[model samples]
Target: MKDVIFDDFQNTVSESLIRHKSILDIITKLQESNARINRAIVKSVTNCGCIEVNAKKQNTLENTNMDIESLKTCLSTQVKGTLCDNCRDVIQNEIGNNLFYLTSLCNALDLNLYDILLKEYDKINTLGKYSFR
Candidate 1:
């Protein structure tokens, strides 16, 4: 009887420890995911010069030939020029899509973590009401 009780206690403790570890693992993954998303957001925002007044002004001239020549010169000088409207639109669309996907992923992970925590809480509460013996 004593051995059986000891085994039962050990199994209970083991299960609890496993749940705790799982929660910790999930939390760590969430933190890492959050950090990566934040870094990507910052990088995207920094790299996006499409909306700047200077870029708009540079590209506003009506002479396409002159613009092409200027772009050629700029390219020769290794200076980056404003993106053409089509390219700009494509990039903006891609950024929007990526942001949406990342937001959804984060939300899903958050909900999963919450559910795990709630389950763990309920298990602990139920365990608290029981006598080990």
Candidate 2:
């Protein structure tokens, strides 16, 4: 006789979730779990790169400094074509940052990014014509 703990797919899925509590579980446990997760990931990466943060204030300061550095590196460029360097950099960085933030938000909410974008686009398309002054 073989022992069958989870005989069906649904049971198996439940068992798996119980075995490995995921982001959903974390979110349920902590309202600000996503922020905590981001901070952990950021700090881990920074530590791995030999950056140390002894206090929360210091950690935030370092994180902000890094963000500024990233923006500086990404935003600094020479114009060579129709799009000016600063303009292109600003647009690109803003889009990239928003996409990154949205992606993280979706992950935290357990939402599919592609599907969300498709739905959002459909909604905008349904709005018909609109002029901005």
Q: Give the best candidate by TM-score.
A: 2
TM-score of 2: 0.33
Report lDDT (CA) for all predictions: 0.47, 0.44
lDDT of 1 at 130: 50
lDDT of candidate 1 over 1-133, digit per residue (tens): 6545534543443344332245555455446656665554344346655332223234424655554446544433222456557555655665554443333333434433334445777887887635222
Which RMSD does model 1 reach against the true structure? 22.5
Model 2 whole-model lDDT (C-alpha atoms): 0.44
- TM-scores vs. true structure, each candidate: 0.26, 0.33
Span of 10 residues, lowest total lDDT, candidate 1: 51-60
